[model samples]
Target: MPAESAPVGRRERNKQQKLERIVTAAAELFSERGVDEVTTQQIADAADIGTGTLFLYAKTKGELLLLVQNSHYADALERGRAASADARTPLDGVMALATPIIECNRVQVENGRTYLREMVFGDPTEPHHAAALAIVGETEQALAETLSRLASIPAAEASALARVVSSIMFLTMASSDAEVDIAQIVEGVRTQVSAILPR
Candidate 1:
């Protein structure tokens, strides 16, 4: 409870408050209107801040998207990691790896699908790419480690397997919806992994 510490605490609190407002505004507006239609001005207005304030918080709309995506993605991945801590088999580990990510996407499927389509196919300069890499890079290493353990493979092989695993993951979960049946997709991958592997 030192006087000097009070200022630092206040600064942190204020920064968090501003970020919360910005994120809340962005989430609602983006979900309701879609990413293409929502503007920075609208987010700022919704947050009760100046457009200049929003810019101060984020360099571009892409950066804000990245910031928001990072928030939710990291949470989901953290959940995944915790879930995987007990898994022992390769397929069980793969399930550990895939299920939480897809579970995460399940919550934000629509906007997520829009954001992902834009990321892979639309622009070269999306903000989420770097952030996504950093986020996935963390999980990627864990996934690579687990795959290496389960398959008795070398690091390079494990890395390649992780990429293929992630690719299948992205494809399946990117299509996740409130109503789409994904069990078959999961089953198909389970059936095909051995077929795809060298004897």
Candidate 2:
């Protein structure tokens, strides 16, 4: 008598794998070719799917770009969370979070450089714009949470500090000549936090 193997219906898994592959292919091409120059047909070819098939997952080229950025950012956020989990000080914890920010930038430098320059070609009037804004808002919230845990700042103050540091992250990412030394940024943040509190 032989043991029976467990059932394995792979359609969903296969579909997800294909979607990931497609996104990876798109990110590579987009990084190399700039988002504006990389057409859906090119993404389809890169993904080994037809243009129509690519369109099935993404409504437009802009939507595909959104997917890439959103996925990449999510990965970075997970790393940030893991890095900051054991931080003792709010500054230390927030600093841990910022390391992932640098790691994320280093990993996605090319695609990000291009994407920021092109602004994803996302229409200002589209509902997708709100979705993108929400992503930024979530990032700010994460920063605020870290700050809240690190110091005695009120929620409002913590949120403001988070926004400030985030603005620094954006600026640092954009400046090739101005590489963000996370240590320096963290120190600066600590100084700012300390300034608002007393003995």
Q: Which candidate is the best by TM-score?
A: 1
Evaluated against the true structure, the overall lDDT of model 2 is 0.68
The number of residue pairs in model 1 that clash at the backbone is: 0
Pull out the clashing pairs in model 1. Answer: none
Count of backbone clashes for each model? 0, 1
Kindly report which residue stretches of model 2 are placed more than 4 angstroms away from their true locations once superposed.
Answer: 1-21, 31-37, 59-62, 117-121, 124-132, 177-199
Give per-model CA RMSD: 4.0, 5.8
Candidate 1: where is the Cα deviation over 4 Å?
1-15, 31-37, 118-129, 175-179, 182-185, 188-199
Q: How well is each residue in 85-185 modelled by candidate 1, as lDDT tens digits?
A: 77877777767765666655555556677655544564445455666766667767777887777768799988887777776677765665647655655
lDDT of 1 at 47: 93
Candidate 2 global TM-score: 0.67
**TM-scores, all models, native as reference:** 0.75, 0.67
